[model samples]
Target: MSSLVASAVEYMIDAGQRSTLFLDVLRQRGDQYREHVAKTAPHVLQYAAELIVDGRDLIEPVNYALVRIVPPEGVQIDLERRPFVVVDPRAGHGPGIGGFKADSEIGVAMKAGHPCYFIGFLPEPVPGQTIERIARAEAQFIETVISLHPRADGKPCVIGNCQAGWAVMILASLRPELFGPLIIAGAPLAYWQGVHGKYPMRYTGGLLGGSWLTAMTSDLGAGKFDGAWLVQNFENQNPSNTLWTKQYNVYSNIDTEADRYLEFERWWGGHVNLNAEEIQFIVDELFIGNNLAAGKILMSDGQKVDLRNIRSPILVFCSEGDNVTPPQQALNWILDCYADVDEIRAYGQTIVYTVHQSIGHLGIFVSGGVAKKQHTEFSSNIDLIDILPPGLYEATFEAKGEATTSADLVVGDWVMRCEARTLDDIRAMGGNSPEDDRRFATAKRVSEINLATYRKYVQPWLRNALTPQMADAMRNLHPLRLQYHALSSKNPWMFLVKSAAEAIDGNRKPVSGENPFLAIQERMGKQIVQMLNSWRDAQEALSEAVFLAIYGSPALQAAVGIDPESEPARPRQMSPEHRMMLDKRVAELRSRIQEGGLREATLRALLYIGSARGMVDERSIAALRQVRRDHAAARLSLPEFKMLVREQFFMLLLDPEEALAAIPKLLPADDSQRRAAFVAMREVLAASGVVSGERAVRLRRIADLFGVEGDPQLSNVTSFDRDARASQGGENSQGLEQHHVG
Candidate 1:
């Protein structure tokens, strides 16, 4: 045992010596090496500074600007009536992510022929700006877009990515009429809620003992909180990727990878700052306190922010693999804010959420493939989302090639359907406990006390001591800022390293997968990473459990009065004006349904039923066309059509048997044509599990009497027919027999 221990000690000493030597060598070459590959800093800084200089340019500039959507060269947007606004997240990053490439959200909207506008911001926040100011600015931007596109049928369809998601929501809540349909991608409103053994970011506040550090950092920066700190925090979440994997991948394939890496780094490296007050408010009120969804957060002007106040339909996009903002954090806000699905429905909010199985947080905004599929589907079907009856739904997008309209012209030809989802299904994911809530509440209380103390004692002393020049110098000396500076042309050795790297780029030879040693090293590295991740997950789970146990106690709950399950009551009454508006909307909808609206609904139903059953029929086709024509008709009264549509829809829903029996009465009298129609109707109904076999045959025979051809398969019909015939009896049974006769 002594010899074994000696060997281990010896190995550890050797490893430590090697690591020290390697780090020393890296330190010596770090400035030159970083300069050689630092393509992002120069351009990123230029752009950042330009944004600060020309703040007005941050708002998109284009003609037909709101309604004239110019798609990518190859793609096409089918809907011209819908207006699109793509709001990029300002979370420690530069703008243009939402429209960075042709295969992006803006690209998809433009291709669809929908007028598109991008909501972006300057790198520097306006002096003394707060979240409320930003929210109001966004509201103004949206209003400007709306006014610019008078020809568009609805208010702008707003798409918000990450931090911008909550910003949009706050804006919509404050001015609900400014939005049409709101899409929030990977935003975390229920900040404290997350799945077990996954999503470590949520536990960070509790582990750090909450927002004091954030305040301290802001104070150190002289009232300007460096966004690079937020960027650093995001990087630390995945040390392997941030420190080694990313750079290694580019190094391994420099020839093809350089431009791609540089392009991404351009945005990634462009860190921006927030005012001390803004950052502190966000951390204390939203992140640590988890007050946003609870309706507990108040603006500087003392307006209580209520999420449910937003009257627009909401589409939430989250992913299971997004460690930064997991599915639970993105979705649990609904459950936190509202009593039940009924409350959501009562408030007339159409809430739809889609969960991707595996996409990182950034991928939710910047992935071309995701943008092509998810964004395209959402942009195309904004009208559907807006018109859907108030309820919670899981939206699923399926790609359809031949079935898609303008199939040859579209890149992501697909359809999106919003299917009803239950609250239990959402709750099955991880959620906040009473204890977790208490901890955040405690954090909020402590933050208030600490902030008050800091303002009273520390803030005045520091503010008076710091000058604008000193502040600028301190900002430039920030570690992240220094790295960018040290790598620029100002470094004397940078030229030599860049030349050498460029030369090396031409003849560089990387190890192939076929190399046995390389393969083994890769496998071992992956194994080590997996093991480390497992250990980390286990540790996080235990920590979270302990947090819940200690802080979730009844005494703690009593102290904080934190109840994750409790929700504020929804307002039961609306002002007379609001009620009248709803009444007008209902009347308008009813009118639309009455004017061949049943036909349109039937067509939609048949299309879905056919897609599910893999069948289609003439009646379905006819219904689809008739509805389209009715919609196009100028003089048609919609209220009457709405009634007819509802009557037919409920008839099918309440008593499908009787409804099917009555189909013979409405059939067109022409033997061959009628038979074809009957066959088509059969397929449609069959897809929905509405009818089959003998009952199907009997229905067909009745059609045959109305000049439709009856199938010979009636002879073998039994069971279902026998029951129906027995129940109806006498003349009906005889009618079935006579129809079957040769």
Candidate 2:
């Protein structure tokens, strides 16, 4: 053979050998997996079976007995005035993730002295519970909490994770008064949304031809939907982790990683079923149909499920690396639901979103880092979010050992600032698409058809076939269940391998590395995965393009009774009651603004504006307070004071010199107080890094007018010494109380 052909042959041969060797290793790993399963499965099975046997205790332990809060050892449950209800996602898994760690969302709230309640459920659904029933239960739970904490704020701050996000949104929409601040983390609102060529989960409905398959599966299970299907879908999203990386990590760190894996798997493997009705509704109304944002979803009671109707401030925490629910899906609801920021403002909605660059979906809720940073910041500053002006903002958390006065006080490792962004900026992140609407519309139709067919044909037969015994067996036989079951003593071979594997586990010390080989393998694996993902993207794009070409054509659109060019007409005339209610709300808000002094109003405005900019240095906040205090001290007539404050603020943007020059005019007329105020203003500017030699001279010159002597070195005070006293009576008044002007 020629040289080129020989090289090709060698390459093919090597590829085959690599494949064979890889398969051999995998086969050995599989045996190890089975052996590991034999060893560990019994404990899981026993744990789960105990829960099943003592179902009440398993589902509702005694510690959680009094509203079910089991405080950590050495800790007492101290209830704060505000009640906090944390709802964990029941997407595919069992409960307790939100409270799995002591420093979790529940923990943060609990530590902050809030009465924390965890909303958890059993691995099995209650015999005939539906989504509405669950929602009602949750609402009732919140109401009970509210009744218990009579002195608490209006209602409990309801935090919903992942799947619970929509459930919370639905609950809040259905009964707005029952909720306080609604914090939704890693929840997909605009479910049909995604960056082009990424987030394949959105495409699954289109590929599967809609939610009818969900109905079919539920029917197959004889009325109860299998949650393993959802877990399997999650696993499929990251095949390397599901198939290899996860097991390898355990094997590589067998001694230490085992407990963590088992702990996580206990919840991950504990699959919970949903009623066919519930899953079908979710897929059709929320995921595939995208009706929630469009104000199309209606409750059984006939109230339109308009997300905009939710009165509480909505806080969204999403991540870019979350393949299951990307930032686009989390944030696009704003763009879809409202015409503009003014509409959101008009409705008195406070919407805040934080986007992390790379945390996965689960980490948003479960990562301790996230708990310490995002969750902690959010829990501590929820009141801040509640008071935010109606607009969109990106919440940023920065870790600082010493926070400026402007930083909102938080309980944990980081302080957060809210930065505002335009709706157009949000739109630029990848939403502006009609294709999504088209695809989701198709999914909705196909789902309806399939569901109807399954109900008509398959329902009766499957229901008859599924006895309680059969259902139990099916649940036990589920792959997630088997991993636990096979490790149990119930397995015939488990006894033989259990002790031996335990011994091996004791002796088996892994060869540790800053493993260059492992690192290289990981990098290469990621590159390969990315390439495969790229290929998948190209395929999907081509498929969508073809689909749109065929179905989006004029002929097909007409055939389907869809008018591509048609627009939703203007909203129907507002009823007098609605108009009066809206007008009343506006008048009340305006009245509140009027009643609130300009100082309060300006501080609120500073918060609203500063949060949008992403960074709020000490200077901005100090300036805001100084301006407010100056205005108050000057006792300028309300209108003059407002204008003076406005001019100073406007100058703050245009000319710092002009703004500082304008500040002394707002000072108190009393020489002593005026001098004190000038010194205070100097300290504020110094803290904000706005004070300089020239600014110091101007300040001192102004202070001298009030009979206050200036320190010669004040011009040299580059840093604001936290301990150093501002000159009072030309000497340090060490014990004097420092007055806060703002």
Candidate 3:
């Protein structure tokens, strides 16, 4: 009994010590937040960066700027390699979250020897700045980057995080030529897509009766919308994490977690402002109207932003735990844009997607583990993605396992495999039903009506009533803002806390893991989190229920000028023009079905095998690269290779039988030349171990087309003295001169 009392007393002392450390961490975070907010151009980027281009100086000025990341000590960057440009979302927070740490997107890309650039914006939007100007600025930035690297191997790779994802997509569709492989992390493209009970953010517009409130908020802010509201919405989505879990995590590991927490909060607390027009367009066109993927958005210059128009290989990375941009919204854009994989191929677009099981939206771009793994592999395989045949693929990465073949070919610890996917594959991941679409359409209509009504009835009084000074007061007095102010040294009362924290830091005594009191505290914290989560879930459920009840009414739909029983709102498809273009393209490809020699034949063979297996792995791709490096007399630029691959793929897709038969005609007549080509082809085929199943059968057919028998496995690789076309007077460099739709 005496020993138990002694232990209990010891537990109390340790708990008191840990509590002090936890309080000190919060005090430090508050101080950091104040410092960050007070700065004129504050950012949380851990890396030192040099300014490259300021968009405010452009022809049509914007707030965004481009900065080149200066690599840290021991990190090397190669100007000749593709440059990586990371664009951070401007939904609410200040920029630089993309490079918030050393093990971030910029870090890994720089570590991989690629020069990196970041696109950030000031806390205030430039007067009259719009998203269109911002996008044009980004295009100019890429052009500037290209000008700087005159001899780069490939075009700059653009990675867009969260809100920046859709913005990048808009620009890519507008100016596809300026981009290489495009990566969008945790970005929602299809606004109306989500599971039945999950992702309640999609239901927000419906419950709020549209973007009228957004307009009102803008009015109240005196032509600028406060981003604090956006941040608040994000917080309300996960109450447990926002209110308790995060702080508890810091408290539990205060000694190691303080600096990281403080750094993140510095950016998280630095809210920015968006022009009323900018926020309105985002809400009306993207959130409520669901128009980006539908190709209904047209720029001021009158060019339609068509997802199908983007030829740069698009890589989408989303996570299941990402409430902000769940996999449904991230990936369903494919369904909204194209009818099928054949249409995707016809458009000559390559798309790849990866879904993480549990990483949240911020973690998708900010987590060191994700950067070291997903971002690293993405950086390493930019070339492979660039040269992929126009189609839809699901990219997956796995650690080295017993089944992994040609492990030496992979540069990293994980091997990436891209399996061909169909529209059905995307459909399997849950999307809005036709009924759900009608409801959302009704909501959209209602939103339009409400906004019109508000402008006519409410705006005049509210616009004149709220002055700039009043707006500033409201922004500063926001709960999100007030919290930082209350805890900072700006508050006279916080001086005591700071003094105590400093004293505690000098004599910190964190509790042992086995402490009984610490366990009880942890248990209580978990219970509080559970309570908060329950409230969040209930609130979301109520919102969804209210939205459905109000918008699901047939009477309301009729009043809103929508047919409840009619076909849902499909994407804006320019059927006749697109069909004519496709037919013309098909005719051109068919005309050249029996053209070229080894180059055309090799591409056709690979496309044929890929179609047969419906999958592609790293080994095959690596071997193909190796064969080109060893055998080809002249190197094919990325554009040239992409064109050749697409042309051959189109040939096979148009008429598989004729394409295979023409392979023999395309081959060299000399047996030695044919053997050299055939052997090199077989070497790539066998790179992923013994190719069996339908792929092997396709391989044998390709071999037969070249008049070769017997399967030559990986070990039987023969070095081609030179490319057949090169030796035979560069026969019909098929795709070198022709420019496709950019």
Show pairs that collide, candidate 3: none
* 427-455: candidate 3 lDDT, tens digit per residue: 89999988888889999999999999999
lDDT assessment of candidate 1: 0.61
Q: Could you give candidate 2's per-residue lDDT for residues 1-742 as a string of tens digits?
A: 4755655554454334333333333333334444443331211211111121222343322111114465555544445346778877889776667777766888777666666776766555656566776776677667777777775544678899999998899889889988878999999888877766677677777667667678767766767888888999898777657766676565444546665775666666666678777788888888887887778887777888778778787998899999999988999888877666555655656688888999998888778888878887777666556545455667777566664443433345665666656677677878635644654565566566666877789777777777767776776677766665555555665555555554544344333244344455457767766776566567667766655555456654555556666554232333476668877754544433323332332333232223222433323443534565565654444224333333332233333333333333444455555444445545544443443333343344444533455545333432323222232222311111110011
RMSD after CA superposition, every candidate:
9.3, 10.3, 5.7
Candidate 1 residue lDDT tens string, 665-707: 4543454544444444444343223444344445444444434
- Scored by lDDT, model 2 comes in at 0.61
Displacement of residue 111 (Cα, Å) in model 3 is: 2.4
Candidate 3 accuracy as TM-score: 0.93
Clash statistics: count for each candidate: 15, 12, 0
lDDT, residue 261, model 1: 69
Worst lDDT 10-window in candidate 2: 732-741
> Candidate 3: how many backbone clashes?
0
Q: Which scores higher on lDDT, 1 or 2? A: 1
Question: Estimated TM-score per prediction?
Answer: 0.72, 0.73, 0.93
